[model samples]
Target: MGIGSWFGFGDKSARASEPQPEPAHTVPTSQDLLDAVDRVEQQAKDGKAPGMVQSRLGRVARTVRDTVPRLDTLGSGSPQAYNVMATATNYLPDAIGGYLRLPRQWADSRPVDRGKTPLMILIDQLDLLGATMDKVFDAVCRADAEALVVHGRFLEEKFGAAAGGGDLIIGSTPVPPMPATDPSGPSPLTPPPGRTA
Candidate 1:
């Protein structure tokens, strides 16, 4: 007998009657992937010589260009895109860390808004932002902040309707805590060598 049936907890006959839970589904938004990529690129750029970081960033960009088509198709019909996108996302942190020379934690702690060039971009379909691609392009051109411009074409091609209304939310820097102090008493030095009983 099955464990459920052996304990007299459930009817053996009802075992087949119970419905199985459905697997959870997650969609990878274009903004999320782009932001991840940009973050990695930023770290690489910051840490390495401009030439080295540029070369690596170029490679990553090429990889994105190559993979995005496949991702879009998969996004339309497969549950595997989540895993694929996640795998792609993972590479950025490593690339960033390698280029930066510092630990990933250090790079992550730096402010994303302080760049002369935009630190990250969110690419998606025009409809996602409820704006025209031209308008976005224009905004990027006019914006005072250094901006990473996410390509709308890529978003439209890969994510279809799902890429609509996407925005990149930059991850926050984590603040390190101050060391704890003893609340009970003054320094032991104050008592000085066992004076008296």
Candidate 2:
């Protein structure tokens, strides 16, 4: 709808004339991510990492640290292995950093405040990272290099959207089905005949 549009120039043309803002998060290379993990690990141990962030970073760091010995099993030549490693080290911890950057008032109130806040957004980012970690771990266990690579791309999609300032929702949890309990004394240890265990 700008004057450029009437002249047949697309938004891209108009955008090219404007200075772009620096990105909030820098996409990390493998080495950069590894170094960050090391720093974050030390930070966590030093008790300087913020409360919620500490555990998440520690978990990702530990998972990747344990996987280091088995990188060969995943294959050094496997891009997915590297992708998984980088994403875990990079994006996961970055969310923690994002939370730390928020003002204490905003960060503290976010937990009780009934609105979208920076802390809430960072939490959503962490949730995405945790899910990504699950996929990476599963792929590594299965020695599925391809899946790891794809998972890296998936992380980029989710994290990229967040970095791009898109809405991220943690949404409600769905209740899982539970088995009915019997008041009668212990049922047979084994399922009755003709029933699947």
Candidate 3:
């Protein structure tokens, strides 16, 4: 074995024996893609929170639907494109679920979000997912192999293995809790005193 081969970088025979992880590539069919998109749409409708969250989710859903056609487009139909789309889809449902879990009072208050409301944060996350879908769509539309590679690297850096499952922890920022409240009562969007315009 050469010096390179000595450090677990063995001969072809040894390398071949080692099990490799399946590539993140996904060869999703049109039906599969469409079905996944439908699920995301339903999730958007069902899980949408009140106020800004609803609007953001609506935009994200529309963007996802728009990106679906790119799957059947000439260049963007590659497995890599599907991989990115799939990852984005995976994140959507979980994100909506996270929003549903947070009380409106906490999610709406700006101080809890460090000057940004939870709705703003949620919108940013949806925007990121939509942007990725747009990139994948554009790459496919143009059949630009180089752009495909660039998109792939961005996914790799941004998500690592998480993109495969589309489960990035976007709501990691803490939202302050409200005072005691009735579970059935509506949570009010109240700005702290003296801060009100």
* lDDT per model vs. reference: 0.48, 0.64, 0.64
Q: What residue runs in model 2 are displaced by over 4 Å at the alpha carbon? A: 1-35, 44-50, 76-79, 110-114, 144-197
Pull out the clashing pairs in model 1: 118-146, 128-164, 128-165
Tens-digit lDDT string for candidate 2 (89-181): 656556666566667576756654457766666656666666666666677777756768788789988766325344345567545445566
lDDT of 3: 0.64
lDDT of 3 by residue, 28-129 (tens): 666665676567556656755664666665665666566666555545546645555665456776777676678767776755466887667777887787
Best by lDDT: 3
Point out the higher-scoring one by TM-score: 2 or 3: 3
Cα shift from native, residue 189, model 3 (Å):
61
Pairs of colliding residues, candidate 2: none
Rank the models by lDDT, top first: 3, 2, 1
- The C-alpha stretches of model 1 lying farther than 4 A from their native spots are 1-27, 75-84, 102-197
